[model samples]
Target: MAELSEQTGVAQSTIRSLIRGRLKRLDSISTGKLAQFFQCKLDELYVMKWE
Candidate 1:
């Protein structure tokens, strides 16, 4: 996670929040960074569930 955060320029706290399902939202820039680091499309970063 630390390595990912460093490589992606995202804070560890944000990544931790995401992993813990405590993140209410993800900004486009952060999402893009993560997607780029993971070599995936932006849409692939998260799932949409019908509530």
Candidate 2:
């Protein structure tokens, strides 16, 4: 998670929330950053589709 925070420029606390499933939603910009860090597509980050 620290690696993700470092790579994506997201806060460690934010990443911890994400890992713990505490974050109910995320903005597209943050989502994109996480996806890029993981080398995955944006769609892969979410189970439900967003309008």
Q: Give the top-scoring candidate (TM-score).
A: 1
Question: Cα RMSD to native, each candidate?
Answer: 3.4, 4.5
Each candidate: what lDDT?
A: 0.78, 0.73
Residues 1-51, candidate 2, lDDT per residue (tens digit)? 777788898889987777666786668788778877878774555543342
Poorest 10 consecutive residues by lDDT, candidate 1: 42-51
Predict model 1's lDDT versus the native: 0.78
| TM-score for each candidate, following the candidate numbering | 0.70, 0.66
Runs of candidate 1 with Cα error greater than 4 angstroms are 41-51
Off by over 4 Å in 2: 41-51
Clashing pairs in 1: none
Give one clash count per candidate, in the order shown: 0, 0
TM-score of 1: 0.70
